[model samples]
Target chain A: MSATQSRPEPKQDEVYSALASARRPKPPGRLSMCLTFGWRGMLKIKHVPEQLIDVTLTPVLFLLMFTYLFGGALAGSTSEYLQYLLPGMLVQSVLFTSVYSGVALNADSTKGVIDRFRSMPVWRPAPLAGAVLGDSVRYLVAAVVVVVLGLIMGFDPGSVTGVVAAIALIVVFSFALSWIFTTVGLLLRAPQAVMNAGFMGLFPLIFLSNIFVDPATLPGWLEAFVHVNPVSHLTTATRGLMGDGASAWEIGRVLLEAAALAAIFAPLTVRLYRKAS
Target chain B: MSAQLAIEAVGLVKTFGATRAVDGVDLAVPRGAVYGVLGPNGAGKTTTIRMLATLLRPDAGSAKVLGRDVVAQADEVRSLVSLTGQLASVDEDLTGRENLVLLARLLGFTRADAKARADELLEAFGLADAAGRQVKNFSGGMRRRLDIAASIVVTPELMFLDEPTTGLDPRSRNQVWDIVRALVAQGTTVLLCTQYLDEADQLAERIAVIDRGRVIAEGTPAQLKASVGQGALHVRLLDADRRDEAEQLLARALDAQVHLEPDPARLTVPVTDAGRATGAIAELSAAGIELADFALGQPSLDEVFLALTGHPAEETVDEEEAA
Candidate 1:
């Protein structure tokens, strides 16, 4: 051996500086962060099964209420209208369920759960990313259960495969939406105020979308507003995927719109979450 | 021979708006010695420990734990040190064994190693029987034991305990003391922050008495006690209105100077131990000084704390002060 010695090779962990990395580590093939967080959230659900009372009943109730109350004026036949409204109701229920992201974060803080985690040596982002990953499961299951129930009640859209695609699309969009509120939850000091903001700001976003009526059927200005709405794109995408005849362009626009929503809100929520207490 | 320094902090400062939680301060702890930060609540002891533990950033100065810079090498420092904060709790949903096992996993132990560590800690902390019981059912002392055990799952080289016995009952406090001694025996350097002087006296190799974010006095317990002893006796008068009569009489009788309150019944004369105490009492009685109760004393840490704060030794701890 030579008298002079060179530096030793760096370990796998030294591959990248965490500070320099733009995104958090998703280490290849260990435990996908998605599963770890997903498991934790699922455990909480098993303990408090009562949380399901809303997701199971809300969509069915809303579909019936609208089909019976406003279906005559809107669509003439209640059956034809549900095929249209059920797709939108699926989107609404998934979106509404996403608000729990903030509620869960707030509860953890109030209960000193987050403080306990802070003292522990786990990855700072793991608990957060895990919560999001876990909630995806809840949203996906809710979307599927609601649609399966709708299918049994003669709310047929098209092929089984096509209906599956629509549910999958709604699940992806809802996961993206929940991250936005998770950040909102992180920034808002109190869960009560955050829930109030949801009731106020979120209520309008849901109603203003094309969930209740077709954009062309509305007043000219309102139709223009509805046509440009991102939620409209999601609703349109879901309706197309579930319907018998929908073009590639219609599906493409839905995906493109969904991507744009993710682009705008994903980074905004990350920034808000970092600044959260 | 140079002893390894477990912790070194200098000019560390942190300000929350206008209030300086930890003002400019310096700390040095030798490896394998128990160092105590003795102070009342809000004297910046907890903030100082937080900065050292790498949980809170300091606005100024720097710290090194096991030669790792706290800010620059925080992860490395964290790996070497474990902190049991006052607010920590065992996971209420998880069994006590699971809590320790989970901590072991986070510290990079394998399943077998984690379980072994969990079992060892459970027995050490007297939680063997309650190991499988959910932490929610455990009493306050059992939870505290589990929390401390969890912090040391990796057998950290340096440990920080912040007021670990603040609200504990006497027996429970002794149980905590046993665990703390066991860690020190294993050569873990411990820096304990406590407002209770008795804890410092019992556990620390050296103590620093802090007040209003500054070190007012620091040394071994015996050294500090010696500094404030002036060979004196203190007598409390029974009647609040006892005026100058006692002081005048004792001064004339003792031939040594005597001082008393502006009251009539009390007088303090020079003294050392109980032998000198007997002589002073005999002199007081001979002089016809009507004393109610008299006790010979050297200043305790209580008096030392009162001296630094410029307030009476016995005053209600105002709620706002703790906040």
Candidate 2:
């Protein structure tokens, strides 16, 4: 220990000077702080590229397996089913990816990183908003994966503008949907628990919707739920946008639902975030 | 006038469900010095620091950091103080440089400035070589250094270090102590929370001993030691069997109670007069109690805690079960 201690230590003085010379810069604007946190989220993904597996692989696998397994049984033909299933698959893929936002938030909370953020002078919601914003990239990636695989599998959308519009609508809905999971993330004690609850809630919503089959084929009681399900509305709106121009009413209704989810859950999430220990 | 104090709190309280984590705690920490809140695990040290740092709202009472109310002017307090939490608050998934850069950007530095500041901090903290590696791969000491570096990105007027050296090696702990000293030399007041008595004795100008959600004792290290006694004589017997006889003889010679240590072969006697310790040792030797070792030194904070609270300082308490 004495031998090591005898070595010249220049960094100690440098540390002192560094501390003495520090000048407080004007705090960044709320948007900049959010962007900085968003950058941090992206950096996490970059460092651990395996995080992209769920967003990329899950969508592609669902697209491949669902189109092949259910095409003849449900839609009467593979190519025909491809056109119908592609947009809905996009919706499922993006919505499934949204659960990760809450999971990541819960993980951050447990790890004490959120305490660091809370102690900072930055805008209170910047971390949550920034996480949702970062998850938007994952939503986009999942949307593209499903759509590009659909094009490869002989599904024809007929117009580039329609596909773009469909992808945009699903991403918007996913963004709004992320707030619900963020709320769950703050409420739950563990990331795994948040993930389990998110998937448990989403499974029924996605499976009962018109994503996989025609609602007309379902029993009356089940079909009633399929008709009113928000995910069903989102899938229908996405399918209409990709296949033909959607009605203003249909698009407007989906947008309204997204707005409503955001309005209700975003505030709730912020409140939970503020109170989270 | 209150501005001269780094922190002032009155009856600050925080409860989690049924547990009163911090109940009616008060603190007055003067500026530009390290003030230690010493306690074992789950002693409300973290909870109290959390409230002062504006991370947790006090259920009752009020705190002013740098003369700004923690609850009402929390943003101002946050801008003025930084908390390096008990947990390594830096993101483990990011590189050391990235963590510093992220904080610097959030603190309002431009792209170039953030990078420059991050690199400077990395270099100064001896993390320059590990800057590009993810923090999850860093050693415990490296991670702690980075956490402290993250706190001082903007040189907060007051910094809350909750158990800064809790699980660190002795060398790393000394490094952290040096950093704390350097920060104070640069005029940044530090609120250091630690379970290690020596850490508080080495760095803090004043110490507050907290237990069971309250401050049990507060003073300078010397004052706390003096309160326990002037000094103590610690003797280890070569044979554990003869310890009882030695304890009786030592108590008779020193005119003080002999404390049987858990070691079975060792006994501790608090002595106000150094002259009496020498006489007690002679009496022990005269009784044919073979001595393995003996030392006379000022009362350690452990003895101080024992004398003050009737329990050792390191006894683990489950006060933070709810937390």
Model 1 residue B269 lDDT score: 70
**Candidate 1, A19-106: lDDT as tens digits:** 1121212222225433444555776675556666666678778877997788777888877777778888888888888888777766
For residues B1-323, could you state the per-residue lDDT of candidate 1 as single tens digits? 12378888888998889998787888878889789998877789888987887777789999888888888988777767778876754456667887776566555565686687777667656677778776777766777777877766666688889888876667677878767776777777899998776788899999888777877788987776665544467676655454455565445545456766465555667543567567666865665645677776656545567555665333423342244
Off by over 4 Å in 2: A1-10, B239-241, B262-264, B273-279, B296-302, B317-323
RMSD of each: 10.1, 3.0
**Chain A accuracy of model 1 expressed as TM-score:** 0.81
- After the best TM-score superposition of candidate 2, give how far the Cα of residue A202 lies from its true spot, in angstroms: 0.5
Each prediction's whole-model lDDT (CA): 0.70, 0.88
**Which pairs clash inside model 1?**
A37-A130, A38-A134, B231-B271, B242-B263, B242-B264, B243-B263, B243-B264
lDDT top scorer: 2
